[model samples]
Target: MTTKVLICLYENEVCPRFDLTREVLIAVIDRDAAVLKEKEVVLPQASLEMLCQMILTEGIQVVICGGIEEEYYQYLKWKNVKVLDSVIGDCKLVLQRLVQGRLKSGDILVE
Candidate 1:
């Protein structure tokens, strides 16, 4: 099974803002607790259909993002993928907290 987190960002890496109108970076991990491979996805739209394609194509499980809209969040929840929103700070830190199961729902760094 694959357990992973996808961070929505404008740039290929994490920045101050996710730039909701742009692409998102995908951080993936396999069965092991190590970062397997990292890739970027320039999603056509932040719609549920695009998300479904990402999951089905890449086998992702979680989405650790800076910001997320209500519809996308709902879609992810209904699709059985964990969605961690309002997350900030170091991009890697967010992912680490998630990997260790120490992430909080509303624990986000405000800019």
Candidate 2:
């Protein structure tokens, strides 16, 4: 089994669209300490209520987004899932560092 993670990718700064809620892109590493390919899954935002169920029911461990609504953030935290704020950059690298335990949440992303 691999430790799961979820990262948010956007074309620009802000979340452009809701339907564009693309995959739960995460970096899955095996026991060998090697990096593997990433995976993306399309998720649906049926509504606020549904989002909660989706996460708990889907076994999502972490959520990464450019910026999430404060309200939802609280809900996620309550569920015990790691929530990262103000993450910006190549979603893949961010997830990589996070999985490797090198990335610190809330650290500004610099080019």
Over 4 Å off in model 2, which ranges? 11-20, 30-37, 44-51
Question: lDDT values of the candidates?
Answer: 0.64, 0.59
lDDT tens per residue, model 1, 10-103 = 4433443333435666776655567777777776765656655676566567766666668767877888888776666566666666666677
What does the lDDT read for residue 5 in candidate 2? 60
Residues 48-102, candidate 2: write the lDDT tens digits: 4554566677566776666567778888889887777667666656755665667
For every model shown, what is its TM-score relative to the native structure?
Answer: 0.67, 0.68
- In angstroms, what RMSD does candidate 2 have relative to the true structure? 3.7
Least accurate stretch of 10 residues (summed lDDT) in model 1?
12-21
Best by lDDT: 1
Q: What is the lDDT of residue 110 in candidate 2?
A: 54
Q: Rate residue 56 of model 1 by lDDT.
A: 54
